[model samples]
Target: MKNINNIFLYSALFLSFSVFAQQGKQKKADTLFNKFSFVKASKVYQELIQNNYNKDYATRKIADCYALLRDPRNANRYYKSVVKQENVPVEYYYKYAQSLRGMKKYKESEIWLQRYIDSGGAPGNNDFTKNVNFISSVFGAKQQYFLDKVRFNSKFSDFGAFEHDGKVYFASSRDEGVSTKRLYGWNAQPFLDIYVAKAGTRKNVDHTAKVPGEINSIYHDGPVTITKDGKTMYFSRNNFTKGFEIKDNKGLTNMKIYRAHLVDGSWTNIEDLPINGDDFSTQHAALNSDDSKLYFTSDRPGTYGGSDIWVANINEDGSITDVENMGNLVNTQSAEGFPFINAEGVLFFSSDGHIGLGLMDIFATIKGDDNAIVDIINLGIPINSSTDDFAFTMNPNGVTGYFASNRRGGRGSDDIYAFHREPVLHVEGVVTNAINMTPIEHTKITLYDENDKEIAFMHTDENGYYQINIDRNKDYKIVASQNKYIEDYRKFTSKNLQTELITIPTNLLLNPVHDVAKLAELKDIYFDYDSHEIREDAAKELLKIIYLMLYDYPDMVIKIESHTDSRGSLSYNDKLSIDRANATYNYLIRGGIDPSRITAHEGFGSRQLTNGCESDTDCEEADHQLNRRTHFTVVQME
Candidate 1:
């Protein structure tokens, strides 16, 4: 009886100790997670899961950690287990959907997205649910940017490229020569620090060095913005002051934006902005064009989501006031941050909440005349991928700039990329009659490359206006043709242009082909020197006669006459002119004009010089070329 009692007591003691240890581990894991130390928290949760203690809660926590770390593959795996449980949180479905999308499993993603909606998740929160063809639309968006990874990126998460005073500033976790190499538990990388490099044009960077100032801290620092005068600076950092961290009641140190002044070329006197709070984070500071208003990302009170963009007016005395949230047009029920407003008052930010390709895609705001955000536009591919992309900044010109992304094939977990906005090359114009300046409706306008290959074609509207998009840095020829009219040709080049939208005003004027007298007054169709082959310029003129004969007057009969300059021998010139006439006749035959419509073809050679340039030396080269011409006369119209 004594041995039995002893055995029972020992077993009871051991069971109590095991339960106590498990409870302690759970408390520690919860604390780490609440503090945003996801990496450390995830390990603790996994240990609990392996021991079969609080398996459900640990599993869900691990999934959340992976999601925050942007490890979508691992997140998807863990979330699979989480969603199979009974009475799962509605957010789990949304998160699972996002993880699936990050893996490009779009179909499965859509199913979970629907589940989220069915489980009382707000449809407005999921942009994918609003548009039925959202995926296809995002993939089919035109690529308007060219991206290249910056050369100065380190192997340890470098991002947030900003420009100030001829230097490029960015945040990095590189700890090659730093004194304190403390790593963040969230990523296992060293805390971010601000670094500067000499800026070069279009994605070039020189030697990089740490900013020689007291701005960087032992905790997270950097991703900064400066005023245009280079005096005032705002940067994100941990809520630490005087070598000690300040924490909220939950013992979490939130991010805060600090302001510093440039005195004698070194930043000093750093102070936290008034809008910072002890509980929620307020970081990623940006300024409007004139520095009159400061914009930043925050999760403070009145936020509609995990984070939202907020603005505050910068008073004349350097005090910030009138804090306002940037409404639903710019915010959603997901993380949104890294706001950058260009000189043109255009807002560019990053969000996973908006309809996008996948995980945090860059977005731009479309504002009304009153400067209110009316719509949000996703800046599709190259600027955004299936992973996190944010921290977009543009130069004053707005054509070339830099942004950060964590997509595959980067030097770091998150790398900064330089991008150049491809110019929207287009030519728009009105087609009008040369004689009366009247709009010529139904004229077919065609665009050809330098090689005379037809690339695009359109017809003039009722108002005689036409527009055609063309490739950049190439020569293009545009032809406007209509029945009963002479074709008008215009040639232009889009080389050495840097504007985002290059609109070339190309007004075409066509002459009416009323009668033989009107046709005779048309510009001479000149041929190349010493060649009887039809030149491109001559072919354009020949097309007009073809159109008139084939479409305008099907029963019209025309006579062709060719002439040559005086440089060639009379017999050779006569033979060359006859060959030119034959070439014109063949061209018309191929253009769908009936062969019976031709009345006669002849060669006048040098005998029909339109100018006094009987010899090459008598006039300029242009005048001599005028004699080498072809003329079409309407013999009969029915």
Candidate 2:
């Protein structure tokens, strides 16, 4: 019964607003129509004309607002309206034509644009008209425009998109929630849980939630952030387990900031934020542009409104210092929630209190000293509809941004949507053989970080093509290899690699290793001078030799031979190289090789490598590596 009255009240309010609008009278409304308020202001001008008032300037003001607002819908409406009521300003008619062109009424817009130029419309004022003409002439309407939609089945609504260490961290109210039971006292749902998933997985949906079992009790447990190493997770969980003082009458566990350490890839020992904190709801967290400080929303005391956005200093220990309310420029008497700081230090938050297009649309303003805002900007349509759109978080590079929306045609209640920040990098390329430029099949393309861990890997199809989706300023290595080809390695240097339609195509020429013996030429055996003590390098070579012999001829037993130069006495050389062979034999025995399959050493002494010994004065060190050697020749075939 009481809900009926509230619905009636909203309906009446909407009707009243449609019936009347006063020009520049509302204090806050005048403030928000900042630069583009021309559309609403133009409506007021139209009202004055309807009232039979002498307001020729108001008509032009309407056109000006439409021009600045960039809304072809209303821009065309008032453009025609102003011309019908008054002689279209020779200067304004070109803008009207531009508006028409924006609406795709190109023929009509073109006719008016000509008259506008003939009537002495200045080039500067008609810049918008010229841009419209270029769009129609140069790039036709059929030019591709894409709308990327993310559809996923979520247990609970998802929000707070953060990418750390190449994986996406987000908060989801899912069936796999931390709390299986709901809270009866506050009538709160047990859905708000934290979840993580691979960022760009388009196949079979995986909604596996990775929340610590202990911290995610039967309460609100999410809206989380993860450290770069994924070792520390900072999340907002309701109620303290030890029972700290909670000022909010709702519930003690309703809102609090908590941190937990990730040991062995699992979260442990959850703790609450210490400084600049209260029992009140300290929820809705946002990291600063540098991620040095965190901005969160709370309805605690000392705030001018229902909820105030506060900034807290982030400590190395994951503790935060006394939080300061962003002040009047950032907060208002109305609910101000969901703070987001972009790379430019511009502050973005959502509020119905601030004069805006609708309830809960995002707004941006330069954060100034004394909490004063400079040039507050309202996010335009689609991004900002008459519905709730909040909880925006972007990665460090700022090329791709994410926001939560229940907007429509989604898999679940409130699935998260990702968007390309204008000028996002769309990196695409191809891989080919360096020699012939022909497509190489089955070539593996792996992308790795500085730590040499593979982030993504793929095999080239018949065309030998590979594409990588990457952010800006990150160092990455592209290694391309095929079954028999030497790997083709290349590196893409860091530049302004941030754009949505970026095309950086390259070829990966993989050189095939046709020379089989040249493979791993580093595999060598070396011996000590005048001694048969098998060096560790030589031992390793013998080990490989044993492995290959066993692999290729499973039933073969071979004798290992060690040789020395003529400088040594035959008897001395015999014992020296024999001990060398025996040392290698011992190594093989220690390596789990069969003792039964072995034969003793055969050292031929100085006769083995005395190719020039009969007349030689001396031999270089290079000859030494060759002279002191170990070899395996198959002796007995089992």
Candidate 3:
């Protein structure tokens, strides 16, 4: 009887072991699913579903895997089982909607999207309304951009297109003859590396060559941004630097931004950026045309969501400081990345948080005068789709640009697409001295768009010539400044009048600083309530005076008469006015004007009032503002 009982126990134990072995296989599937290796993960998930092991989870994952793999037919088949399943997450509804859309089932997609909103998904967030509007916008609006896939796409993921020095640079996972190429388990693709090729038009492209060892690494290395001069390069890479590695939570190495100098036709002097931290990731480095500010994506602390776009001020010494978040207007409770600022200050980035067609969509926003995000709107269809679309960039001409999209009908996982817009506007002109009418070489010319936002700035070539791209149906302000001359300002608009490119040529004739008081009336220099610091606009005006003393009229001498409104005691006003005058004097010296050029900075203490805003009487703020003025007079010019 004891032997028979033992035999029964052994049989039960064997059955339990068999069940545990099957569960292990399911766990492995979950691992793969988490890593987004859907191609491999779906096999195990489907097997588990067939065997009725965790059938609900397995079914949902199988559907999701197919959706991510862009196999909408299979995704639709599998999703049908869980789209209406009980207690599923709201994201399932969104995913189901996208899969339906990809399968060309618009009605079904809208139904799922409505269900998702009704289930309290992304409520109170413009998300629901944006998605619904996107449907109508896609069909109602005319497509403004035509996209064509480039010729260099391999059968693997390729993206992050940028153009520099007449060469096309991008990131790719193609086998680039690197023996050390290792597969990233996350997607089972080779690690990304930077590649360069000859510049090509939309129709033709040359084969690519891998960057040198100085830039490429054993790990991911690319998606680089080069300065307008192509001398400095900023790129993204893992934290493996100088034999050290930085890792974040879960022991995963995070990405960091690095800078390289173009030394003797090769990239050298690689250094990790100061904004990078080991605890998070920083990638996608982009620069404004001037290279004074670097914009990038990071998952660092203080981010609004999984990631946010941030900018760092690049100092004259080549060090970066003052990292700033792009703020709530641009970032949201989801990820935002791949920021590209065109020659115009308009910012273009990809975000999953904002209302969009699908998983991720491209959006554009203009920076406020304070350098903060002011407005944001989706780029709409063709430029955006029901899948990931990012890495947007434009040529200096603005009309021609490239972006990466993983939407259906792509040649690879992610392919670079060239886009062209019609009715392009171009601005070309020259800068010259107003007195002599001679070309002013190296003069700085700045262009501002309708919103009074800077689009771009450039130093005039040898002939004081410059050309830039501008958008039609918008107002623009062009300012020209050169050493030894007063800045020139002009305002104009492009009405999209012609089919071909329209060139608006306006030559700038800058005046000498000593002649600013004669040529253009100097405006009142305003300060914060009680602070003596000069305002930004005021500083720009003051630079005109500095230019005269320092460059144009090196022997010029000037006297400053600072005045204040009669709001305080006479003694207090006198001291305050003196402080203001000293502040302006310091500004000129700091701006490189010789101290000896200034004869005197007298504080009038409200004695010289432009209007009657006396301390003893009630007056409007505007009246007081007029009284607070700094008058400049040329004492001598040689």
- The candidate scoring highest on TM-score is 1
TM-score of each: 0.52, 0.44, 0.46
Worst 10 residues of 2 by lDDT: 135-144
How well is each residue in 1-638 modelled by candidate 2, as lDDT tens digits?
21433453455454334322322232122222232233355556566557432244445555555455445677677667666644444655765676787788888977886776677755442444444332222111111122346544464467777666666667665554233455435424344666666676564333355554455554566777765556667788766565553554543444777777887667778776763254467777667545678888888778889888888888776667877888886677888987877645557778878765467767765322233444455554545556677776655554466777666666565667776544323233455544434456678888777677787776765445455555566676778877666777777744655343343455577655544343342243558777656676666676565544333234556667777766656789888777777877787676545777777666666666735643154777676557777666555654
In model 1, the Cα lDDT at residue 225 comes to 96
Residue 157, model 1: Cα distance from true site in angstroms? 1.2
**TM-score, cand. 2 vs. native:** 0.44
Q: Point out where model 1 deviates above 4 Å.
A: 1-130, 133-141, 164-166, 198-208, 368-370, 427-446, 456-468, 477-496, 499-501, 504-638
Candidate 1: minimum summed lDDT over ten consecutive residues — where?
132-141
Give the per-residue lDDT digits (tens) of candidate 1, residues 1-638.
11432453455455446544765686677655543345667889999899776576678878876665556799889989999976565777877787788788989999998888888877553576444333223222235578854788878888889987788989988866755579999999998889888776444332247776789888999789999998988999999988999998988899999999988979899987899988999999999889999999999989999999999999999999999999997899998999998876778899999878789999876554354655566777788898999999987755678999888999879998999876445677778766444567789999999999998887886557676767788999999999768888999998877645446768899876656554443345778887778888777776666545543455668788999988878998899999888888787787766778888778887888887877646678888888888787767866
Please give me the total number of clashing residue pairs in predicted model 1: 0
Which regions of candidate 2 are displaced past 4 Å?
Answer: 1-147, 153-155, 176-189, 203-207, 212-215, 242-253, 275-279, 316-319, 367-373, 424-638
C-alpha positional error of residue 427 in candidate 1 after TM-score superposition, expressed in Å: 4.5
Backbone N/Cα/C clashes per model? 0, 13, 1
Per lDDT, what order, best first? 1, 3, 2
Clash pairs (backbone) in predicted model 3: 484-552
